[model samples]
Target: MKDSPSRPLYLAPYYIWIALFVIAPIALIFYFSFLDLTGAFTLENYQNFFSSVYLRMTLSSFWYAFLITLITILIAYPTAYWLTKTKHKQLWLLLIIIPSWINLLLKAYAFIGIFGLYGPANKLLQALGAGPLQILFTDFSFIFVSVYIFIPFMVLPIFNSLDKINPALIDASRDLGASSFTTFRRIIFPLAINGVKSGVQAVFIPALSLFVITRLIAGNKVITLGTAIEQQFLVTQNWGMGSTIAVFLILFMIIIMMLTGQKEKGGLYNGKTK
Candidate 1:
């Protein structure tokens, strides 16, 4: 199955792109992580990260990301399953995807109106005679916006996995006296777990690195790894510490991808490995 040496020539552009955009930037960040503010080699950057203040921020970033991923999975699994059963799947998927087409800033801005003091949330509560409740810049608002932004990343992968399922397997399960719920528990869910892994990978890693929504919605009360990285690099002009955070972030992402990778593929319920 070995190809001619020229075969790799077709991938020259891809290799170049990866070298210039991906590898080079990561190399620079790794190099900077080893240096201090004066461009001298030192371990201060690493020390600063393990310090209590920054360590807490790192944990908070992961905690919120976990919550976002959990909620997204709970909502996306059912929605994706429903979409598979719908007559107009494409239209429904488009509706789910349409919001992503809008700019992230614009979407955050739109939510600002909804969560503002005199906005729809307060208005609706007033109508219910429950009075206004503050949501803007709170932890609840932060989680809500994260889930809203990342739900599609979760749904699309699960939907693709579900749509790829074989109908005959379900029919055979029924003919063999398996109930719908039993069939799903034993057959459907295990097969679709690859998609769940993919969805979690897509949502959680980026959530760990996002600061914008936290900034606009959660304000100074919430400090994530992304916000801390931004502060070290931009606000504090501490590139070494920022690059250290960026390196660890990349490390965490790699760990997630490895954990999510499939050991095998199955498209039908034969209780067989192919």
Candidate 2:
């Protein structure tokens, strides 16, 4: 059969969009990574990225991203589980997601006030006789705000996964005398593993590249690779080093995607005898 003449026409815009937005920017970054500040080709940027300073920064970025992802999962999973059990599950989920619709900068600034010296957090502490503690510009605040921002992202995927579970399977587990923990560990979580993977991919990748939250919430005390890239490009005007970091960040993102990516195989059963 002959193909439709309009098929390629239909796809042209998509191809052009990918080329301009995705391919072109990456090619530019890769090209820039090999250049020095003077626009001369050099490997110095790559060499410098492997140095102790950048190595420490990279490790710190990974650490914070891991912590944020882990904490988000801990909080989001239980919340999602409860949401699934609610009488008005969609309404509850909507409430949870509503906060995420607010501008991230607005939320950050709001937290800045909430965590400030005389803010409600400190006021509560003082009321309890512990005195106002330094909450803003601290690791706790940074992680807290990041977790708050990412919870909805994590919850949605997990909730969808959990919601898709056949009630019969859960009932079967219960009928078999499995404890709630055992049922979750053996049945529910295994089925929802893909959703957890999706959530991890959604949360972890952005967490690694977080700069604004680190600056606004952590007061530049916690510098991720994204912050370093921002400094290189904007603050220091070193596009080469920034692109170098970006190239590696892209590589990291690819590796993480690969690690978390789902594999297609038999579902429930392969319909074959062993």
Candidate 3:
């Protein structure tokens, strides 16, 4: 059917918002990335970014983010699989999502209490005759908090995908003498790739950009590109350098999405869980 000209009008507000908030900001970043400290056109921002210190920090941030995403997927996929089998799955999912609604700073504070010197974790250690372990301001604490924070983002999509799989197909596979592992490996996992991709993307993008949790949990011990960007803009007052980092991050996100996303049979990005 031919679309009405007014169909475009229906999306006018969305287009306007996108232009103002998204395109305009990106264009400004592009402009900033090319400018020097004196506002002259230069590649100095990119040059400084590729320097050894910045490059090493950037790679470390990527590694940390990747580990956090990996751990979330490992835990979330099994939890989601079990959720699909439960009678009260909706309630379970609600419980999983409830914590996410809490303020992120609040969650960080809560972890502070739990991981503090005289906190419950150490108290338990003392009771067990083990010395109180220092956890605060460490890489372990940072990764722990990150995985805690992002696991829900991984769970929902995988649950949706698993929930949509046909029980009849499973039954038939079993009838045909396929083992449980074989059935899942052959029939289930491949069908759910899109959901897995969605979950990973949801977890990875924010984790890559994470700054506050690192500061709160790892102090200066953990530094991400996000922290570097903040340092450039807020402390160093280097807008050009900050914008350069932001552009690189945007490119990194695009690369990750392209690498992880699957093509649907129709030649589009496969995002629908079912």
Sort order, TM-score high to low = 2, 3, 1
Query: All predictions: root-mean-square deviation over Cα?
Result: 5.3, 5.8, 3.6
TM-score of 1: 0.89
Q: Which residue pairs clash within candidate 2?
A: none
- C-alpha lDDT score of every prediction, in listed order: 0.86, 0.89, 0.86
lDDT of 2 by residue, 1-274 (tens): 2766556666799999999999999999999999999999999999999999999999989999999999999999999988999999999988988887888899999999999999999999998999889999999999999999999888888888899999999999999999999999999999988778888888888898888899899998999988999999999999999999999999999998799887743221211110
lDDT of 3 by residue, 190-228 (tens): 877777888887878788788889878888899888888
Give residue 172's error in model 1 in angstroms: 2.3
List TM-scores for all candidates, in order: 0.89, 0.92, 0.90
Ranking by lDDT: 2, 3, 1
In model 3, pairs of residues that clash are none
Best by lDDT: 2
